[model samples]
Target: MNPCRPEEPPTVGVEEEYFLVHPGSRAVVPASARVVARASAALGEDVAGEFTEFQVEGRTQPCSGARELRAELCRVRTALADAARAEGLRLCASGTPVIADADADVSGDRSGDSTLTYISDHPRYRAGVLQYRSMLDDFAVCAFHAHVHLPDRETAVLTCNHLRPWLPLLVAMSANSPYHRGRDTGYAGWRAVIRSRFPCLGPPPYAASLAEHERLATAMAATEAMLDPGMPFWDVRPNPHLPTLEVRAMDVLPDVADTVALTLLIRALVATAASRAAAGDPGPRTGAELLRAAYWRAARDGWPGHGADPLTGRVLPYAVQAQKLVGHVRPALRAYGDEDEVTAFLDRLASRGPGAERQRARMAAEGRLSAVVDGLVRETCPDR
Candidate 1:
């Protein structure tokens, strides 16, 4: 457990992406709102709806670090699972679920939206509809979002600033969107590209300070490009409603354990960045160029690609980048006293096998797209 000190920082929240499957068919089901209505008693006034019908999200009670975050996720996943099961439904956690049929529309049903029958109504959703209507015509996507609390707006801004270059690293580390529409999309995180369909919802520009962040947000809002601060779909972004940094790039992790590992890694990143900034170190030398390289790298090869050097644009296979990033963030990992957690969880991910690689291999052997998706269903949620 991460011992929470009074000065150890304030609040942290997590958002989860879940899908309902049609029982024996194991295909997508439009049962989110139905399950949500069923779980409201258990959710007990604590939850938020994601952009799609298939996605039901929950925000955790704020916390200081990873230990608390894990507990929160377990609680929410359990509740959701129980509620969904009661309705003869099962929940799936993957970037994209395997489909036997294409009738499932992931992008919000505009008709559903027009009637205000959707789950949540943040301005972000409204602007997203206006900006990406073309791409979203009949598409539906699902993902998990993790929002970590910072002590102040400045820390949030600084976290966003320093963490930019490594956004791709985070994305790569969590890539699980290997298969889509019954086919391997070739991209490690097709979901990233899928979600990028929204207008004001891509990566944020390089901002030096809180003032600059405000300026960027103003420009986006004024142009009516994005709905508001809720947009900006950077792999790592600042959350306007709360004093936290939200990571929007990861796919839904396979299991509670893997989700715990990913959560620990993210918390370590934010804590290290925040602590360094508070002490005046300003974090690492990551810049837009290097960051863009990381983004493209993950969008392309996921965990296998080598990280690119910010200075020379040279790629240092993960073998090389691992040394630098681990060395660079070691102090914070040590400071957070999460070295054991990081090592334990990361080793499992490294050895347990990467999802995308497994997906591609499965497709080669199975020679069937449905088989690939079925393999994924087995991978993400196994019936014990």
Candidate 2:
């Protein structure tokens, strides 16, 4: 047994990015600067700016289980919503904005240029835009990020290795962005496709040791290809500032319960992997090409469609894939008192379908993309 292993399960923290849209028009508005300013002033540092001026990100404090995670997520969402309302804008948790009217013109007096208007004015974001150009503009997407605490950097890196094969399953579960720029993108999570354009964003290569991971990062940073160590935006990577593994595969889920469920699933998965690593298991040896294909398949066809089996790379029913994932992490789930919640949530998700399916259904029913936005805003502000 590993003496360094903590008695308690790792704590989970969630970071969610949202779009600030005009309540009536449903168009993404360049109001995040104002909204974040007011929200951060009222809600502390958790409220922050995202890549685009139309987006805001909220984070939760590290929490032990689904109960505390759910409460903290709700509080953060409520705080963001309250602040957005105070600024006369509505906050939405959808992965992509439903509205396509980019020329809506956010400039009141400054510059008077709408093309140069939507990107955030923050220095880091500006640097990203300058470096990536159209790619950054195409990334009006939001995501639900989970941070799972680990004992040390070594364990964090090892957990990422063990966690690789399972990333696509989580992507399928949390696939939320179907509609992009006012039209159906024909993919459950178009955000994945958009984010893939980044040279540093994707599944990480297998590292022989923690030193290998550092060397890869150092090389990437050396090329000036990435802004910093944090710029190598792997689907799962060791957090730059925290002793945690940050999973970025999932789109920004619409429902709070879904978000909490995803968090619990991630926590369980990481715990299971860390346990196995402690027991001398080196994780799966899946090939890089197969892994990339698995993620692409999930992004293209979420739940209710076929998913690549995590272990074998064979096509399987989405339900079957989800079952396999649950089986893999069940022990950790029970340890954290999350077995029931995770199982029930996945079952319901399979039965009713994920947010992408629901969005498509609404678009079909109402015969307008705006209705999808309406549904997303309603789901985002469930308490309202």
Candidate 3:
């Protein structure tokens, strides 16, 4: 996560990604006019559009903690769906849609050069086609992005540094990118690898302060690589325009509730880390060691990395890791009145593991690939 670190109060915001599904066939659709029109109306004034024509992002008003984050996510998702449904469109939170071809490039012109579409313009979309021409050599990709506001850039940097180790866990937590272009790709989070094609992406650079981080950003800027801020494309990143930390790793989830829960968790993490930082306490585990641990797990096992501290070279089983994770974060969640949210999310994770695991189970059992795509959204669709 590229951020500024300093001691201060913590602020929170959320950005959620959605797949615009055609209500007629439950297939992916380029959620352009309808998605934007309805979402702009349905979401509060804070909602913003993402780069993808089919994707839209909703942000929270600066929030206090887990409970507030939950409320913010709930309200935003309800409004987003309300807007999407208004035009016979359904919102899907899955990391990757069932049909890789679920969505259409409504712009009819892929002019943009950034994977993070700044707008749906023929020139810009076409610009995107020409850019990232090297990294996108393999596999198709789609993604959802979320952001959390902080009190200041400096504090945002601190939260980012501390949270780096956990970004993979968050991705593992939000593992929804199981399929690739309508096929059951074996990887749990294939998009994670696919998106790494861009320059200066994947994990973040090491820096102690936002100033140094900016220096790095400045250096990258000199290379003329930033077609869009979204193009920097790290898993846990920040938005320069918005006063928030943007978490870009999660595959869009099927259920808005899961997204909500994940938002709550992120808010809790930021709040807790900020609280610790405010009192001169050490913050979350970050840096090269932690980042290495998380990246390896997310790339290999996805969320099940919860079981072992790959960084410490411990091969603890999944059960042990689960206990460790609960032990570490439960107090924070409980303090935020989010124990229930944590529990519900855990149940879903345990039952299905990651989306990739679930997809594999189905595909292996049925010996049919289409079933995997068809059910990806349905399986993870919002639970109530």
Model number with the top TM-score: 2
Better of 1 and 2 by TM-score: 2
Model 2: per-residue Cα lDDT over 1-384, one tens digit each: 131343357888999999987878888887887888787865698889987788999999999888899899888888888888888888887888778575743232233333456667778776775577666656788999999887477777777888898888888888899988878889998888887777778788777678888888888877866777654678888888877789988999888888888888888888778877767777787788888888889999988889787578789987888888889877777767887888778877968789999999998899987788888888987875
lDDT of each: 0.64, 0.81, 0.60
Can you write out model 3's per-residue Cα lDDT over 126-153, one digit (the tens) per residue? Answer: 4555665534333234555666655366
lDDT of 1 by residue, 249-335 (tens): 777776666666666567666776776666665545555555555666776788766666553467766545544666766666676
Residue 235 in candidate 2 has what lDDT?
86
* Backbone collisions counted per model: 4, 0, 30
Model 2 superposed RMSD (Cα): 2.8
TM-score of 3: 0.76
Worst 10 residues of 3 by lDDT: 1-10
Between candidates 1 and 3, the one scoring higher on TM-score is 1
Q: Is candidate 2 or 3 superior in TM-score?
A: 2
Residue ranges of candidate 3 with Cα displaced over 4 Å: 1-11, 23-27, 44-48, 62-75, 82-88, 101-119, 122-130, 134-149, 228-232, 275-296, 305-311, 315-319, 360-384
Candidate with better lDDT, 1 vs 2: 2
Off by over 4 Å in 1: 1-12, 63-67, 107-127, 197-199, 281-290, 361-384
